[model samples]
Every structure is written in C-alpha cells, then in structure tokens.
Target: MKDSLLWDLSDIATNETFPQLIADTKKRIDKIVTWRKHLSPQMEKKQFVKMLNEIEDLKSVIACIYDYPALKELTDRTDIKAREMKATALDIVIAAEESVRFIDHWLQGKDVVGPEKLNDEQAEVLFSIVPEHKHLLWRSRELALHTLSDVEERIILQKDLQLSEPLLDLRRIIESEQQYKIKLDGEKKTKVIRTQAELSKLTTDANPKNRESAYRVLFKEYEKNLDKYFIIYQAIAKDWSSVANLRGYNEPISMRNRANDLPDELIDLLYSVCSENLGIFHNFFELKANLLKIPKLRRFDLYAPLKDSDKTKYSFAEALDLVIDTFEGFDKDFADKAKRVVAEGHIDSHPSPKKAPGAFCATIHPKITPYVFLNFTGKTRDVFTLAHELGHAVHSLYSSVNPYSGQNPTLPLAETASTFAELLLFDRMMQLVDTETQQKLLMERLADSYATIMRQINFSMFEKEAFALFAKGTNPEDVSSRYYQNLLAHFGDSVDVDQIFSYEWAYIPHFVNSPFYVYAYAFGELLALSLFAMYKDSGEVAVNKLKKILTFGRTAYPIEMLQELDISLQDRDFWMHGFSVINNWQKNVQNIFSHERI
Candidate 1:
C-alpha cells in the first residue's frame, strides 16, 4: 500500500562498478569451487562452511542488481538512469552465463558436485533446467538482460518507433513533451510536472469521459505513428525467436517448458484440457451478464464493477492492513515478514509516468528477500493484486534457505501461491456479502476468474497461433490484424469488441514481451483452486504441507510439487476435477439466481 519503498542495493547489490563487481564475484565463486576441489574426501566440514559463506557474499551482489532495479536507478524510467543500469545488467548477465557454462559445459566434463553431498532425493532435483545453473551461478548477459539491451538499443531506444527513412526524429518530440510545463489533473492539482506522467494517468482517471478521452489521445498519437509501436514489437519477436532457434530450441515454448522442467506431455495436456473447457468460462460469463441485468457483455463490461453495496474505499494504509489481516489467518509468520516488507522500501505502490503498468514481485536474492511492485489506485482489484504478489514474495522467501538452485519454481508453479492467496481472500469475502448483494459479489468473483482463467487462456491460444505466423516471416500488419480478429472471436458475440479494444494488442506487453507466459495463470489458478479445495477435508496439516510446497521451490518439478500435496495433476481426473468444481460453483450461481425466486 505504501506508494514508494526505498531500495537498499548498496547493502546487497553490486557497487555500481559492474566490471569490478563481476570480476570480484568471479574470484569468490572460483575460490569456493577451488576449495571444494581441494577438500580431502575425509576432511569436508568447516572448510565447506567457509566456502559457502564466500559464495553467499558473491550471490548477494548478483541478486541485488537483477532483483531490485527500482532501488538503484534505471527503473521503468529515466533513460539516463537505465543507461548505467544496462551496463551493470550486462555485467551481471555475463557473470551468470559464464558461470552456467563452467558448471554445465566445464564442470560436468571435470566430474564434480553430484548428489552425494546432497541427499539422493535432492540430487534427483538437480535434473531440472541447467542443474549447474543455480540462482546467481549462471548469470548470463546473453540470456535475458543482454537480449533486452540489444533490443532496446537497436529497436526501442536507438531505432525510432516509426518506420521511415526520413529519420522521423520522434524521440526529440517525445522528450520535448516530457519537458512541457503543464498541470495534469487528479492527486496532483493543475501543477506543472513532466508530461509523460501527465499523459499516462489520463487513461486511468476516475472520470469515464476523461478515461475515454485519454484513450482517444493515446491512440491518436499512436495511430499517427503506428509504425513505431508495431515495428518495435515485430523486431522484439524476431529477435527472441531467432535467439531461441540459435540456442538450439525448436521454439520459444521449448525454452519456456524447459524453465519449468515440464514434460512435453504435461504442457500438451494442459493446453488441450484448458482449451476444451472454455464452456465453463462461457457459462460463468453468461451468469454475470444476467446478474448485471444486461442483454450482453461488452469489452468494458468484462471488468465492470458491482452496484448497490458497501464500497469502503481503502487508502494505501488501509489496503496494507486488509492484506496483513487476511494473510495472518493463513500463517502468522507470513504476516510478520510481510509487514517488514512494508516497513522497508520493498514495495513501489504508485502510478507514475513511464513506469510499467501492472503488478509484479521480484525475487532479488535467496540470501536477502524478495520485493513486490504495484500501481495501487485504491480499487478493489488493487487489494487482490497486492495479495497476489505477496504470494510470490512468500514463495521466494521459503526458497531462499534451500541451497539447491532449483528451489526457484517454474512459471506454472510461480503463480500458485499468489493466486491461492487471492482465492482465500475472495472466498472469505463472498461468504460475508449480504443476500441481496450476493449476486454482485458472485459477479465480482466471476469477473476475476474471467480475467485470470478465461482471458489468459484466450491470450495463450492467440500467442500460439500468432507466434507461429510470425516465425514464418509474416508481416506485422498481418499479425496485428489476425490478432485483432482472434481477440474478437475469443470474447464471443456478447461483447461489442469492434470498438474500444482494437488497440489492445499494442498495450499487451506479454505477447510482444514474454511468449507463452500467460497460460501459467490459468494453470496455477486451477491448480491452486484444486489444492485449496483439498484443504477443506485435510485441515491444519494441509496448511503445513502447502507451506512446505512453497519451500520446495525448484527442488520439485511442477508435477512432483503437486505430489507433496498428494495430488498428481497429470491424472486426467485430477484436472477434470478442477473443471467439476467450476461446474459445481456455476450451479451454485444458478441456485443463487434460482433461490431469488424462492
């Protein structure tokens, strides 16, 4: 809820001299390995401990740079700040990549560090991803960070967004807009601030007319310069796809699945099953439309708020209180540490210009702790977003102590704790709503599912098709037009998707950004729902098991982590059981409407 949390990178982060930091970390890591190699087979005690301490010191530096960007400078803003940040990022990346190569390409050849020091079960866990590539172990400038830099340099910053040979010179215009002295509305009175912040908040204004006007303004600007946003997105896809190919991946999906250690069967199964069940989502949406007393659902109606209820506006302070209270019911230790996150400057919870929209949690370093970011606007969804990201923070916290590198969960497992936390809050609130307001509450809950499960699944489907098209050298216009058409069909005839949503493609950072990341929302939400449903019968012991699962991190593959909960997701019935719950819940909704007559 706190809008701005101070970042303390100096303590754990690199000294900003990236080259020196990389050089120093390399020395420490090499020493640790050297000591390991020299230790006599009979004499492995205090010497090992000393080596671990040295490794921790180096990890602290690597994590601070990658995890907590908001603290050091180049956040989603200030090109100048990002310049130096990029250099530091490059150093961190190169360090990681080199480390991974040494362990996988080099150490494996040398025959060292297997499951003996670790339990056999623990040793089996090393089979995930690059086992040699632990958290800070395989920091590669080439993988994510450097790719981002190269793209930004050649695509985002250096090459203009517009596609023209006249050297359009739009950056200068944008920079001038930034400096234009003008007063924007809202929290900041008509006081002069930078134009970027002013332009952005205009879209999120409380006033519908203002929000609509802001949308018009945005597209008008973008429409005139469609070439830029389009070209950048195209280049990014091309670059990532090419990189994936060069790295010997069949496609981006392989790389993604590899990160999660998911088998081809599991992923293929998830895609098939989730796609097959859009009926449950459709039924849920139809119920929502009936509750809202509308003939049809609109694009805007998809996120429409409930009416005639006690809507208590929560300040940032109030929002934090609600979160701490809800999470405390689950685990006191969790609530305690969550408060520390607030006390320290871990959360950046405010809307600002040039800063990325949406919320995310950063796993800075296992040795330190994780941080959460949000653009809290005191809305109902904002509270849940906070809870969701907190789930990620707690998950990261448990994985920190696990010495094994795989403790960092895959993307599917990544969303489990966060979405589970949200369900806890949602179910508790749904139970408390008044009889007359239950319809509204049900609609609200259904809307959340619609976004997470329904919409995300649709996005995944679109990405699958679109990426395939792009890979064959389809032009940007063809990709964008096809994407717009697909978005319309997915939403169904209920929504007037023709207007107010076409430009949606340009704003979606995920599709242009991270390929195949959206389905994990649908995957984790259903998994969490299934697991939470089990808690009703299992009781307190189940709660402990849930916490233990979070601690599993990368140690257990997605399928194996479910095993800890005694639920195997691969079981056709286990997955269908998730669908059955949704059907039962939808029936409950029908009953709620039916009981209205009684």
Candidate 2:
C-alpha cells in the first residue's frame, strides 16, 4: 500500500448491502434468544454445546455488522450515514444483550431462588462440559457479582444509549474539525495542517520556535473550547461513577481493575513502583538536556530530536518491509502473520482531514484478520507505530484457536504484542547504525519509555484525583487546577511545565473515551520490557513462551496466562525490575553523552 492510501472495503459489506447484513444479524439474534429461553444448568452436554454454537454465531455476525460502520466512521468523520448506521448497530447489539440477560442471571442463581437454579459452583459444573470455554463462563460468574437486577441493568443500558453516544461523538467531531498553521524552519510561508497527526509532526520540528508554536497551536483550540469539553468530561465522569457505585465497586478505578480480572492491590503496586522510580526519568531529562546543549529542558522539548540526529524518512512500503524484517528476526511466523493484514488489504495507511488522529487495531472477529488504522507521516516513530498496530493484529491471529467469547483480551494484557513489536524494531534499528546514530536511537527509545510509562502513570494519577473531585461537585476549573498540580508533582525539578500545559488533560481522548485506561500503557510497557529482557537472554525459548501467553487470549486471567513466563503480578520486585531495565538504558545514554560534546 502507498502512503495516504485507504484500505480496501470490499471484504466488508458496502452501504447497499450493510442493511441486509444487519437484518441477517437480527435474525441470528432471534435464534439465539430462542436458544437462551431453553437454556438450563441441567441441560445435556450436547444441547449445551449447540446453544454455545448458536451464541458464537450471533456474536460473529454482530461483530461484522457493528464494525463495518464503526470503521467507516473512524476513517471519515464526515460520513453521516456511517455514524447513523453505527448507532443503529449499537442499539441492536444492546437489545440483543438485554434479550439474553437470562443466561447470566440463571448462571448466578438470580433468576430463581429455588433449587432448580444454579449458583457459581453449579454454573462452573455445567461450564466444565466445554473445557475450552470454562474460563470465559467463570469470568461471567465473577462479573455477575457486580451485576444489577434485571430492571436496573436495562435502565443503565438505555441511559448509556441515550447519554454516552452523543457525548463521545461530539469529542470526535470537534477534534477532526480543528486545524493548525505552522511556518517551516526555513520557509517564510506557513503550512496548514488539518489533522492532529500532522500537527503532532511539528511538535518535534527541528526548530525550537516551530516546536513551541506547535504546542501553542495544539492547546489553543482546546483552551478555547475549555468549557464545552469540561462539561462533556464532567458528565462522562459522573455517569461512570454512578454506574460503578451502583455496581458496588469501592472506588472508580476498582471497577476497571475488576473488569480486567486483576486484583486492586496489583494496580496499587504498579502506582507505588512507578512513583518511587520518578528519579529515573528525572535524571534522564537532565541527560537529555546535556545532550541537547541546553541549560534546562522544557515540557515542549520532551520529544525534540537530537541536534545532529539522523533525519532519514521511509516510504510506506519501506516502513512495512522494515517492520516485517524486524518481526522475522524474532520468528518468521510472526513476520508472515503481520504480512497477512496487508495482504488482506486490512490497513488504512495514511492521514486525512477527517480521519481519527491516533492509531488502533480493530479485531472484528477471531476468524477475520484485524484491520489497522493509522495516520502515517513517514517519520521513524510512524514506522514503530506500524509495527505496534501490526503486533496487535498478530496477537489476534495467534489467538484464533479460541471461540468468539475467548478471543478478546483484557486491557492489561492487550498491549503485550504491540509494545514488544516496537522493542523488536528498536533492536533491529540499533544493530544497523553507527555510534552517534545509536545514541540518537537510545534517546528516542528513552523518550518513548517516558511517554508510555511515566506519562501514562501520571495521567492515571490525575484521573484518580479528578474522579474524586468530580464526585464532590467540583467544577472544571478546580479540576484543571488539580491537574496542573499533578503535573508539577510529576515533573518535579526536572522540566519546566507551563500553565498552558494544564489544558493538556482535555486534549487526551482517553480521559473522555476510556476512564483509567492510561494505566494499561504503563502496565504493558513495563511488562514488555521484562519480556524483551527474557527474549534477549533465552531467544527462541522466550519467543515460544510469549506465543503461549498470546494464544491463551481471554481463556484465562492475565496473571494465570503470564505463569507461562513465571511472571508474578503481586511481586513488587517484578515491577521494579522493569523500571531497572529503563534505568540501565538511561545510564547508557548518560555514559554516551559524557564522552562527547555535541
């Protein structure tokens, strides 16, 4: 595929045929409803298997019907018909879920109080009939503990349908519509960049003035619409808090912890380990300043390229080949799987004025090769993003042995392959460059480490405080002030953070899209660091172990699946070891800078 090329949509239904696809999905849903009506704990194993098959079939169809329009809407935000179709698809899925709510209620023994109903133990006994799906069924029982009564569940679903959709859509619409103008380093004329991805390129522009101007341009729009964005965010927070409270979670983040099937204590440990390691990043910033020959580093200079850094740019095809080659160095099977996404024409490889800003991999179903969406600008980082997203696709492909119910991973484990992909590419690039270029690569790696680990942890910290403040009837301005304080604590004396940076919180889509989702990036990056260390030491053996974990998919909890690698979720030293790997890299960069003057 060429740069800025749209993916082939023929594999998915066209607008002319999409309505029929939804109609067919509804018919399957009706069939599943009939099957659910007859479901019982005491049913024969053969009958139970048949019901499972029907449910999986319905889910497969629903995935396609829903994803078709959703993918279209992401690529072209101005596609009104795509938006409406996505809404219709969502409503149908919600109704289908409501119609089959009896399954969970019956499994939890909530549908009836008498002896005929099944409790957790009895449900597990029935679930044992399908050995491959036992964990999925058990997970359902765990979630049912937090499930509300049938009436309350329906009300919440209806409320979400009415309130959540438009709020999220508003954010997407505003972001896609915003534009920025910046003067090139050597040119007097200004360039108009319409997408966030394009604007992000200027933040790392070689000229310091252009770098600062990019930040100003980026935050200015957010500051202008501060009130509107805050209102939307505040409502989203309250809505999430209300639902989490009704479900009996102790705190806002606790709900996310439970959804990931992780213990709250584990997340707490991650926070503690990262907070204690703040000095590592602090020293790295000083090292960065030394290499740049600057007295101090500013927040806007976090991602600034080294003064003599290599400025080589890759074409779309070159980037793809590099990623595939990097994966092939680990395992040819991995390289082939990454190529399948492209061969199937499942990647949208460029930016557009109306396209979504960031990158993501959407796995519609286990049988389908995942579709990747990117705003490729041909920078080296964009090459890593290509590897990152294709890593997600490889993860999905590896887990194809599972049924639909077991195909999706929890948030914490979801970043494993993607982060590992970037590291593999980093390793490959490091081997091909000279000493100075190696130093530059190390700097880029450290910058990414800071972004993925410290930055994300700080975002989660702000979220924890923001949610508490929002619950106390605090306004947006107060929350903004608290966020600024949070940033101060994060940077400490290492970097200068400006007040305009406080508006940065509103610019992050995760806070509005997925609350508490930032921690997963930290979780994944640390976990990947540890995994990369293993791969470096043991080679193919470690590679096989990593594959085993991915193959498990949602078949087991993250902690359980990670046992294949002997990883412990509750061990403080385990998390600390990941930080140590980063510390070592920073030390190497420091050593390199000490030996030479830029």
Predicted model with the maximum lDDT: 2
lDDT of 2 by residue, 1-598 (tens): 5555577765767899988888887787777767654666678889888887777877887888788998998989999999899989888887678656766577666764333667666677778889888898877877877899878887887787678978999888887888887776678898888988778888888777888889988898888888888998999999999889989999989898898888888898899999999999999898887777788889888888888776778899999989998998999998999999999989999898898888999988888889999989888889989999999999999988899888878878889999999989988988887878788888888888989898999999899998888888887678889989998899999999888888898899999899998899899899888888878878999999889888988999988888657878778777877787788888887888778865
After superposition on all CA atoms, what RMSD does each candidate show versus the true structure?
7.8, 3.3
Per candidate, the number of residue pairs that clash is 14, 0
Query: After best superposition, candidate 2 residue 468: deviation in angstroms?
Result: 2.2
Candidate 1 lDDT, 511-594, residue by residue in tens? 654667888888888778776776655768768878888887776566766786777878866677666666666777788788
lDDT of every model, 2 decimals: 0.62, 0.85
Scored by lDDT, model 2 comes in at 0.85
For model 1, the run of ten residues with the poorest summed lDDT:
137-146
Q: List TM-score per model, in order.
A: 0.72, 0.90
